[model samples]
Target: MKTNRHSLMAKGIMVLLSLLILIFIITFAWFTPPEERNDAHGVSMKTKAGSDFEYAIGFKTSQTFGEYLVTDFTNSEDSEWDIEDLHVPGKMKDDQITPVSYNLLYDYQPIDITGDGYTLIRPAMDYGNWKINTGSFDYSIAEANTQYISFDLILRSKAATTLSLGPNSYAIGASEVEGTTAKPDGSKLTGADVERKSDYGNFSRDAIVGAVRVAFLGFDDTLTAESYSTGTQDDKLNHTPSLLWVPRPDLYLNNNGNDLSTSGWSLNTGVTSGTTFNLQSQAMNDAAYSTYRHQYYNVFEMTNPNDTVEVATDNSDYVHVSAKDTEGNEYHLNDSVELISLDKPMTVQENNEDVTYYYGKVRVRIWVEGTDSESRRALSKGKFKFSFDLTTNG
Candidate 1:
């Protein structure tokens, strides 16, 4: 009887252990994560799968002055890719100013793959040799990732003076090298093309220079050669006197002591009938006068009337002027003067007075430093325009 009981207990323990093992197997089969699941066969199995492959690129629509000029490209595919080559095609309007020089800033320094930075990537003639070969460095775009390429558009001071006030467009192209793919229409990837425009909407003729008028204060004809030399004479002398004097006849205007005035004096219109002058129409407030008074007078003298002259308070009097956009952002005049000067042009709408104002009007001032005839002839007068095209590839 004892032997029979022992056998029965041992059999029951084996049955219970089998039932636990079965429950564990069932639970694991139902609750296992998808990545860890086995095949239908009771044996463990593994498999690899992926989706349809693709590739693409895109750019930002607009950019403002003083802001970083960023050009970005995106890759939309599972495969890694690289930019084989890039080309930027640009052109200017037939009558617009030609771009002489440009300096581009890169996020990463360009490597000397071929020992010549110019041959690889540099500003050349209008759309001639502006192509860049970027294969040396690891300029890679990971699966479904995006990369940004930026440039700080810099122009020679002389170049910015000639930039036209309108839209300038460039054709930019980028070619894929590593993994050339096809489009939805089944065409292979030759290259991608995009259009970019540097719009100078705020720097228009209507905005910079408005209606203009001129008035010449006549010469004081009362002085003789003898009286001119004598310090006792208080007579107003016209033009530069034969001899040097402290209070000599120079171009002077009534600015309520602002010293802002137009060009030379004349009986009829100031200087000439068609001659235009840019004068500070209003008086400088105490704050502006205290801060920028010296700059105001200095720029007023150096700047030519009617013609677009860049003026800056920081640089030398002869240095090219910087400009502000409609948003009041400052930029080099050579790059583009799409905005007004910080000195501010006067508007008739605000002042409501005639008196042949100069602030907002398209005009320039004239002043003879000495008796030099050539210096007087250096005054420039006319309307100016500039246009150009630019292209980039990466």
Candidate 2:
């Protein structure tokens, strides 16, 4: 009789355990949205970040000839950056700045002719250019809220080296990288939507990536004072300091389907008419290399503007495709691109160092090109990565 009772008690315990497991499964399934599910249906975006925009500078794990670093203006010995894991990259606190893990900052709002999206603004540079006066505290390194996102990097080489900078293609979740399907007029996609297996969305744009420009500003001769220059062949690149443009080709808008998504003027050359709204075609590759400076566009309007843009003089509801840089330099954003520098010097800092290897600082400025035809309000949701490759040009 005791044995039978013991068996009955064991059975009861098993039943309780099973019930608890079932409850957990039901609760999880009921509360979790498809987008947040752990399954591979919608969540694995092949990126370390989940924000509207994700970025990284990666090199193959096999290449270890020289030392490469992503660091900030911190005085700590461990100032080296961890790019693969999403870490707080110069998060701006009213009182202090520290590296912590957090949600990434989204795109700037109300994009206009006078907005931050219009040009390559460099507020940070090596030798402590990014440091600012806190008033209450000593000068501290800070990042702009909307103006731009800059990264500090150091690359080491024995001598002058020419690096190969290439871009990666993008793809939606479990979808082919055919291309984006959303039209420039902020309309829904037609051939790449995951739900319909056709119609790709605005989450990624090809021309958007092409319009991005990265320049190796030059090498640094100082490490504690303010300095900036667009030096000639004497300064294309070399040891201790440089500037680069980290491209976010997969950048998307936060509120894509809202009324605001359909309200902006499509980039220049979009299919539009006087005060009448129409959807733009799939894409317009307005990212052409400027043999001669494309005069900054001047938007023309016929009273109420629609989802179209054109040069001034003609009576149409469109905008001219030109903007002023941070320094009041007028040039179309599409025309303001510079390729990465070649054979820059490298910097080295060791108490008893050898002349074989050298190190240099590189400041990467990442932002969306505001004048690209794909910069419409509707195409907002995408992920892309960067490939930083360097090889001798011998």
Summarize candidate 2's per-residue lDDT along 53-130 as a digit string, tens digits: 111221111111222222222222222223322343343455656543321122112111211222332211112221
TM of each candidate vs. truth = 0.14, 0.35
Q: List, residue by residue over 59-166, the lDDT tens digit for candidate 1.
A: 111212222221111112222211111111232235655521112211112111110101111111112111111111211211110111221111111011221212
| Per-candidate alpha-carbon RMSD to the true structure | 38.1, 20.7
Q: Can you tell me which runs of candidate 2 are displaced by over 4 Å?
A: 1-147, 166-216, 219-356
At residue 337, give the lDDT of candidate 1: 17
Local distance difference test scores for all models: 0.16, 0.25
TM-score for candidate 1, please give it: 0.14
